[model samples]
Target: MNIGTAATQTGLPVKTIRYYEEIGLVTPDRRANGYRDFSEACVEQLRLLAQARHLGFSLEECRRLLSLSADEGRASRDVRALAQQNLEAVREKIASLSALEAQLQRLIAQCHGDDAPDCAILDDLMGQRGN
Candidate 1:
């Protein structure tokens, strides 16, 4: 198959596939006419990459995961550690976003959306709170 068929099979954009190729993620063979020729295994790898990206794995992480998947003698503990690390980072982001949401709610509650020129949101943004 070709790159288009591979993209369709993997649910990734053509540009994303090209970028993955550029970053040495998936190496599809090239024909004599310079067209990329994707094999069934290459398409399967692309699908795995798409799922990994959807699960919030970075490209570097995806590379490592792919390597582990290809390694028949690899231990499952390594994969578990990587997943745990990613989960921790996601938890931290959720906490940070929750705090931001609370702060924004407070600022919004303080703002009286009337004809008044003084805005609490603007004041908070300008570091002039409690003024």
Candidate 2:
């Protein structure tokens, strides 16, 4: 199959597939005409990459995961460790976002949102008012 068919199978964009190729992630064989020829196994790898990316794995992390996925003797503990690290990062981001949301809520409540030019949010952002 071609790149288009692989993209359709993986539900990924053609550009993303090209980028993956550029980054040495997926190496689809090139025909004599210099066009990419994706095989069934290559398409399966592309699907795996798409799922990994959807799960928030970075490209480098995805590379490692792919390597481990291909290694028949790989331990499951290695994959679990990576997932745990990602979960902790997600938790920290959620906490940070929660704090930001609280501050934004406070600022919005303080704002009059009327014709008057006295904006509480502006004052808070400019350090003119206490947080």
- Give the top-scoring candidate (lDDT): 2
Instruction: For candidate 2, report its TM-score.
Output: 0.94
Model 1 C-alpha lDDT per residue in residues 28-92, reported as the tens digit of each score: 99999999999998888899999988988889999999898889999999999889888898899
Best by TM-score: 1
lDDT of 1: 0.92
After superposing candidate 1 on the true structure, give the runs of residues whose Cα lies further than 4 Å from its correct spot.
Answer: none
Pull out the clashing pairs in model 1: none
Backbone clash tally for model 1? Answer: 0
